[model samples]
Target: MTSPLNTLPALEKTLQEVEILLAEAEGFDEDRKKLVVLNKAAFLLLVGKFEAYIENLVEEFVFAINSLELRAAHVPERLLAEHSVQIVKNVKDHLNNGKLEKVNSMFIDLSRYWAEIEPCNSLNISNKFSYGKHGEKELIKMFKRCGIESIFDEIVLYDPQEKYDSNEDSVLDIKGIFNSITNMRNNILHQDETPTLTVGNVKYYKNILVQLAECLEELLQKIISNADSKRQKEGMFDYVI
Candidate 1:
């Protein structure tokens, strides 16, 4: 199926680059993965680009839904709640620090956000998306706020190799892979010891990210299309009898 997502193609290109790096590291031979640092670079690039793809995909979804001019009542309740997540976090942080002045100001801003938001206007999407420490938990939480429940279940991933019996019984472990990759990248970046690096692993991880993004794109497209369907000439629901 062709994806409507703008970011998926670019993400595919990044994964291709990771494969290119891996091939070069192996001296264009599949016999063995050589050059440990280059292989590590491939892994890091995969992790960084994968993270960016998820973030940009969310931003894309928000902007697409905003353009539809759908009534807020028609928008998913969790999505509306998501719009205030950042402000609420700020309020908590300020109160924790004993910054009463900042806390009061945040409350004022919160009130304004509630008062000024029009039912048929654009959603006030929060800018402070906290997927920086990328993992399964971060991805699931972010998607849940956007009204996607049990996102991992919603995604269907396939193994690139004919090696696995079925995608449903994937050995790659789709749900667990994101956190594993992020943790491995952190160890490689922060710790002094060199982590195990191989061309096969690099390519395997790249395919995993690509498959995840592809499924995510399909999921978001469906959501945005549904939102667009709710809009009419008046751009708000009239509750017609």
Candidate 2:
């Protein structure tokens, strides 16, 4: 049977591969020969893979959200109202165009219209939700989008002694961590400096990425569990005779 937890193992395996590549590249970097170009190439490969991993994690997160039977009630009223208006306009246009030759045909068209608009509206809402730019401030915004910002109140992951200083009492500086990774990735892609990569730097960022993947996994699991619990409480699985 397939499991949603498969992402964790995939992430772990990718990280292992990155570690091996980095180790080999480090050996080349130490040799200081013409073949040191291999080290630069490996660094580029690592950056590309790491970026892909982050993007895939986000895609999985969006997929998990879409898979859940989340209530549309939580969606903003203004957005829903906008879609409702568009739907009404569509029906009005259909009716005004004098295409209602058959009542049955009109009803069928209406059903099709509703079917088309529902998924579009859901997708629009999902697209509006962002993980934010790679930074601490942006990360806080992302947490708000996830509706788990309050969890930071009790469990501080960034600093234990520093008092929560955000406008909204937040204990975790996850944004900073992500921002650092993003900056390193950008440098690798845009900078012309050759052979600046070190095994230490690669390992450091690799560890951070691993931490991020695990955190995202936990968050996705929590969302699935909460949705399942809610469904169970609602007796959504109850057999109807």
Q: Which candidate is the best by TM-score?
A: 1
lDDT of 1 by residue, 1-241 (tens): 2125577777877677787788788784454435787888889988888877877888887777766645665566678677766667778888998999998876665454345344434555643347345578778877886789879888767777756766456545678777788789878877855677777888878877888888888888888776666555345544322
Question: Candidate 1, which ten residues in sequence have the lowest lDDT sum?
Answer: 232-241
Model 1, runs deviating above 4 Å: 1-3, 28-34, 85-117, 127-132, 163-168, 232-241
- In candidate 2, the residue pairs with backbone N, CA or C atoms under 3 Å apart (3 or more residues apart, or in different chains) clash, namely 135-175, 136-175
lDDT tens digits, residue span 116-165, model 2 = 32221232222232432344444444444444553234232433334565
Global lDDT scores for all candidate models: 0.71, 0.50
| CA lDDT for candidate 1 | 0.71
Clash statistics: count for each candidate = 0, 2
